[model samples]
Target: MAQFDEVFDWVVVGSGAGSMASALLMKQAGKSVVILEKAQWVGGTTCKSGGVMWIPANRFMNPGEDSLEQACRYLDAVVPDGPDSPGTSPARRRTYAVEAPKMLDFIVGQGVKMERGSTFWPDYYDELPGGVKTSRTVTALPFDKNELGKDWASKLRQGFLEVPVRLDDGMKLPFMKHSWKIKRIFLKIALKFVAGKLTGKHWVTAGAALQGRMLKAVLDRKAAEIRTGSPVSELIMDGDRSVGVITARDGRPWRVGARLGILINAGGFAMNQAMRDRYMPGTQAKWSNGIETDTGDMHIELAAKGAQLAQMDQMVGFQMSEAPGWDTDYVKPGTQSTTGKPHAIQVDQTGVRYMNEGGSYEEFCENMLVRNRTVPAIPSWAIMDQQYMDEYGVAGKGTAKKNMEKWLASGWMRRAETVEALAALIGVPPAALGGAVARWNGFVRSGRDEDFHRGERAYDNWLGDPFFKNGPNQCMGTIEKAPFYAIPIVPGDVGTYGGVVCDCDSRVLREDGRPIPGLYACGVTTASPMGRVYPGAGASVGPSMTFGWIAARHAAGLGNQFG
Candidate 1:
């Protein structure tokens, strides 16, 4: 038995989407719950994210378009099996495929509104078996933070987009310069912004919308307590079972007990340089966009208590370029959306065009790290031409004179009159770069990428210039326009993908394959159920919230509601 200053039916560490979901479920079950957040704000990294949840066969999807069998097949094809991918064992994968939709239904039943993502938002590998060209992604509608009241709204973590825009709006906003449809969408968003201001509604979109709605739902119940700036330092153990945790209150050590279980939704170690060096080498913490509170303190505490940690090397890579103010920005400008656009290509330090520039961000950065094993490619260069500058711009910035000068002055961007001169500026062999450009131009003319199959998938085309008039292929365009430019791209991550291993029930598991009683975990705190593969949008948040639901149900003795 452990001494405690307070007790609850459920104690959740971290105020992420998963933590909030579990706390909500516990409260609904008539159990007392508390959420302890290390950060001063609620909503964790999920609030700072795009807030898309990948739920196959969701209610919003057309009936018969997706099913458990189909989703399982897709998972089987993409997520690797065997001991190497122990986190995504056959049983766990099946459980996720089945329970994900149920989780969505449960969340919605609790009054968290959601709708399907873009119809054009295809799976990364749509050509694969069981893959859907239509989206399985679900996202919350834009929410008004004013509903949360001033104090609670002030405590909510801010996201990238302040204005209320749908997730699909983000997909189309990049092409406002090209398409009439995008321009109309932009006009609508602007009008909505004005109307919202007049109505005294402070709207927020993306992750903030999802989290704001959830936070409102949680607070509306008024059954669960949420404490910020309270970090769970250590777990209180009785024999092999976790009974409580040691956290802080009023700058003093405070002990809190859990009558049911303690759930660790405390996120990953993307901000911990020591852990990054040990697990994911050739990566820097500064490049990561994970929230500052994601220092993996819970991971260390879990490991110290004999929890088995696996797949620690994997990260949810979101390839990024060093923009003028990248270091200080809330969400760094990423090159993932830019490198795949027209009139641009990615190459190693030796000026050789490598993997396909378009696809999932995880695969993009995985290829970068893998290529670095053979070539000096850690800081790969994204080579572009004046046409790209004229149309697509660089790292989400316009090609205005001021923006260009600012980038050039900061050395974050380089430009030259010729391809060879550009290569020289970026420290690559001029001849090799020139040859690569010539080869890419030839491919654009032939409409085929013999080297890496650049734009064969629906996803690749989605990341491309839809309004490109000169090329037959949306992703393939001549990089020959004068005043060539180069921007160095690194394998930046949204969050690390690996941590302590858990079972299908979301119970923390030991090396011997036994569950640590009263210990549950979800989100990035555990090795992800997707294994090394990023299936589609919201893969991380989807599993995190689903498993959090599962953990709560198991703790409450609900006995697998989906089962």
Candidate 2:
């Protein structure tokens, strides 16, 4: 007896950072909005992230000497404009440079807690032109779940850590600290958890906190609705204009009409094998860390409806290693190679070192792709001495001896008494491995990596063992210990970078370079604003939320107006 079809002023396809931000902005503009999430939970892969937003000249942080001009200069040096990568367009760049700070201020004004993340977080490539040593990234402040009520708060995504910790607290303290400082920090975190439990004040941090606050705003506004377990299968069109979406719920199709526009923010094609095979070469969809639900349904359906695609061959990547307890089938989502630690060196299949081991995850995967063109660079081996293993642990796991025993017994890692023996076990030539180790040890003695300049950059030093301060080279340490180990690593990606092309206003474009009315996109559904390069921490989420905000205002016919 009830109507199977519904109508709203705006409908968002996904409930990630982009979709949530868009929904909130539209609600603030007095628009009736609804969100469609395929999964039962609200957060996507963003829940697994650090939830930092890289906004240059943001008012939330002390901008110091950073300005729109400096930000543009940095972007120009890193992200080049091209037909395939429209992220570097002057109009889009300027829009992002100016509107990003405003977007941040707007969200923070909506009861979303925030703090400066640049004091300790370094830029990914601070040595580059227009790059600063700090103060461009902001992170979500921890939230108490009691404020949202139990039933409503339960819908939020669970964090990856046992205790609530901010991005800078989680990233900097554990990986870079003295033993005493690390212990003290852990104790402080433990005490906070105890106090919270006693006070019935449950807290969540990182991406969960970020999405939770946005979700709270949506509910607080009371002008929006969220429908989970509703997978949008297609878009409904009136002539050439997108009017709504056709979603599948409870094994039935329902048409949800939008009066203004339908914004598609349902992530990228990272989990679609067919798209992966067609776009990314020498890489498979299984290697992506994106959520399994992110299979490009919106992208495929929209592309069929005449939306133009761009930057399909690029991804935000990392160097990932697998352990026995980990999800080897898909490689763990946050798996990272422990390359910057002392006495550890990454080598190609030929037992030859390819790049600076102390580089960022994006840099690591970029170099791996370049090497894959001519040689078998993926599944590279990370060789480390027992001293390094004992000090910094192996891969991205902890440094406990019990963990080491479990890894060794389960065959998750290969170990030997000497470098030559370890090389033999890992199918690397003994002589080649020996020579690489000798050269690395020589660099350690001189405190200089003439071959690759591993510890030359401040960003590199930030990732290195902070306790090991030997002149300017904290990343270098002699691998002369008795026992050695080798771990197999492969090129892993966080998410695909390619999607439909959009203009500065975030309107999806046709194949002939014209904007399609009433059809907009944000997040990974649109081509990245940073092109193929990641400028700094939270680059993906930052632009995703900003553009999402932009898309809603544009649909409301107030694109030119700002508060």
Candidate 3:
């Protein structure tokens, strides 16, 4: 409601994880920066994620002790040059390959912490180039809610699970906690629910914890501020070198100048149906976990300022619960990120395995399109067994139970005490459904999935619990545990990765492949490094934050040279 103007050294738009990380780091470097967010809240979809930050060769990762090199080998074997990749040109990916450590070091050195998992999880398609079994995945130790300086911790957003306090570096929460009854769950959640009221040893949820910690550092900077409810309508370009942005901060327009560059950390086009129709047609918006503010306005506003778009046809799609009130259906209860493991099998309309059932969200969609004869890709079921659901608590037991009830009540759930009856309702022939289950059961009984090899890799079994049967035991759950239930599975996504083209340094390129001065983009707003592929856990956030820091550093004139 206030109309005023001020100039800063840099302007970062969209205060999501990417923007917040960039702004915090930029301010750490003594650059005067301002972050603008269109949403009423600051964290965006990140606050709702599972909260794991995947970084290879990170502090907790043991290259000599654990062998991250094996994983890198897997990734190189799988990850090709993503199309419209601005920075990952053979040169950029290679450069980024080397710089990743230092870039990581910069954040860690600046106070962002990290903790590597015992083993890294693959990005669904562990069989692909550059894909590895484990080690690059990491999490941050949880922050005490009290450490957030009261006001910061009190009113912040909440994730689905009760996050555990971690010890060590920057990585945060990784999975959802389940198995407890809904009452115990809610009681524990109630304590966290009144997060504002509790004081003792409070732990931060991953996405929010990560962002909040980063925000704490950002707010500490002199002349740096987080401006939410600010949506940039126009670029204040003096010629081509983007000088500032004219934004609407709570319906009041204000001009904030950027001395060096205006960073478009505003995220991607997942929430924008118009942009979805324009580039990634047939893609559903509700599947994405990206910021609600990421509706392509920043892309259009930036393009009007001379930024070219890239990777506009692909998105980071995942199989989400088609449950009501599940806007993006975040699989990570307390965190805003998914572990991205291929625990679920995506079958075609014929109930046949289509593509690699465990492909990354992006790869899943692209493969579906490439294999479009597999009609009904959009509404496909991510088939799983009752045992698997009971063990990991992924999607959480309470949410799943309620969701099952809702589905059963709304007729979304196809329930039959027998697999054959369920197949009839789902239209999958009794023989086919019964046969698939029988084969799957055989895999469970034999402890081997000869056909799909679901748990062949250590990554696929990440969700498996110790109590599960060993050998034929691994994650193989019997579908025979009736009443056999099938909640309608819908395609979900972290967000869309189709937007403006940018180089590795996060500078947007025009159609002519030259940098659009004063304009830089990262996160979903810029082309992703994996393109239509997800390399592993923390895939989108890894590049989004890494490149976001890269872009902010570049805008500050501290990073590498631009061609």
Candidate 4:
């Protein structure tokens, strides 16, 4: 039997960007800290993400140009207009404003290289009121794969690594071409990748980059350490204040004490069936909201000890393909929305358009459920024309044929010559389906989709190869093109957005809305600062990184002292 280690000043759970940042920050604050990550590999879901941190007035980008007041004003436009919302809660919003700069300073000043890769990636609703088009997105300087060294390689998940696969497979060509003019000003990502290899530049992806960057700073300083495959089974409670965690690894069970604080940066339930069924009852998912291991029990366990939970009902559900991860994702890249692609219109159970095809994840989800409340959801179909198949090449070859064949052969998709005939085959009321397409066509012709505003956002217009030079725009083929196609669309999500709420100090909150003693949480375990609107190009990662730094530093008692 392995002997249990005694105690550290702080202990963190989960290895995602937020949790890792916490561990790193705590260590920098001169407190002994240990990170217990459930993943065999480190980076968590962050490694699998696009790695953008939407920090307003961050030190790296528009340094000396941005301020807290400006960030708040920009946020005022989008943060849900209500009490009990992220924007409405002064304390929670303040938490982000105060610590965001510190997090950026600590991580970047420590040598985590960064660049503005998203000159073209606009806000989710850039064209909407109060949306800003530029300056919010940031990316890691291109990283050399060789720079991770051997220790980090096997631990990296392959699923999140697919972007490189597509790049290497010549998909980058289409991304930079006349047909795919999605980006007007390319960050030169492909060139950067090539240069990174040659120049020995090592970079992080999405939130993982932020997490990894922070971890590197602390590890170099030897302030904290992370132990993979160590899962905290229970909290070490000492008279109402949690003291340590009982972690099990390699068949050995033991307790690792936390002298000062224990923060659960573990993620939320996009993967766990119970939490998914409870919080987001209608969402269909196969992978995770963040990670497959992000079971909701961490809160349950803490709650057993009287830790109050907040916003258990809210989750970040985006539109995912019918097949979920990997195989399904091949039909469309993660960055692209389900709308205006080589598919059919997305309708709810009542067979009516519920959202703009180019909307963000949360709005997409909120609207989906709102529509579902009024109707019984049969699968929504993606109606495609044979001309669409031949001309556009069905999701650019290979992927389209494979998934569509599987769907058609499996009866999930049907094809016919007319929109009415195609709708009849799927049982979605031929007239309703016909009218929907006609309305959609009218929107396409006038270059104005009045119903749902298909090409409203700059992001959407860029993705569709619309004939007009109107940025990324979409058009319908009039099913008049014949040999129309349709596939069932079911609403799904990446994960939930709520958990143990915390303040800028990274302190967990009590039932009375007080920061709980010696406890903190980041990642999906806390209230998302985006306040129901995803602003950052990689919105999820920004808060995760910022909060991770906050939680870790505060837990290690370094919140005030760190440089």
Name the best candidate (by lDDT).
Answer: 1
Q: 1 or 2: which has the higher TM-score?
A: 1
Q: Of the candidates shown, which would achieve the greatest TM-score relative to the real structure?
A: 1
Model 3 poorest 10 in a row by lDDT: 332-341
Native-vs-model 1 lDDT? 0.90
- The best-first sequence of candidates by lDDT reads 1, 2, 4, 3
TM-score of each: 0.98, 0.94, 0.83, 0.85
- Which 10 residues in a row give candidate 1 its minimum summed lDDT? 393-402
Task: Give all candidates' CA lDDT scores.
Answer: 0.90, 0.79, 0.61, 0.61
Q: What lDDT score goes with residue 167 in model 1?
A: 84
Residue-pair clash count for candidate 3: 45
What is the per-residue lDDT of model 3 for residues 508-554, given as tens digits with 9 covering 90 to 100?
88878888787887777777666555666777666777777788777
Runs in model 1 deviating more than 4 A are 400-402, 560-563
Off by over 4 Å in 4: 1-4, 60-67, 81-88, 127-130, 162-173, 176-218, 287-289, 323-336, 341-344, 386-407, 410-412, 462-480, 556-563
- Off-target runs (Cα >4 Å) in candidate 3 are 1-5, 63-75, 82-87, 117-132, 149-157, 160-202, 249-251, 324-346, 355-359, 365-373, 382-407, 442-447, 478-483, 559-563
Candidate 3, overall lDDT?
0.61
Worst 10 residues of 2 by lDDT: 328-337
Q: Higher lDDT: candidate 1 or 2? A: 1
User: What is the full ranking by TM-score, best candidate first?
Assistant: 1, 2, 4, 3
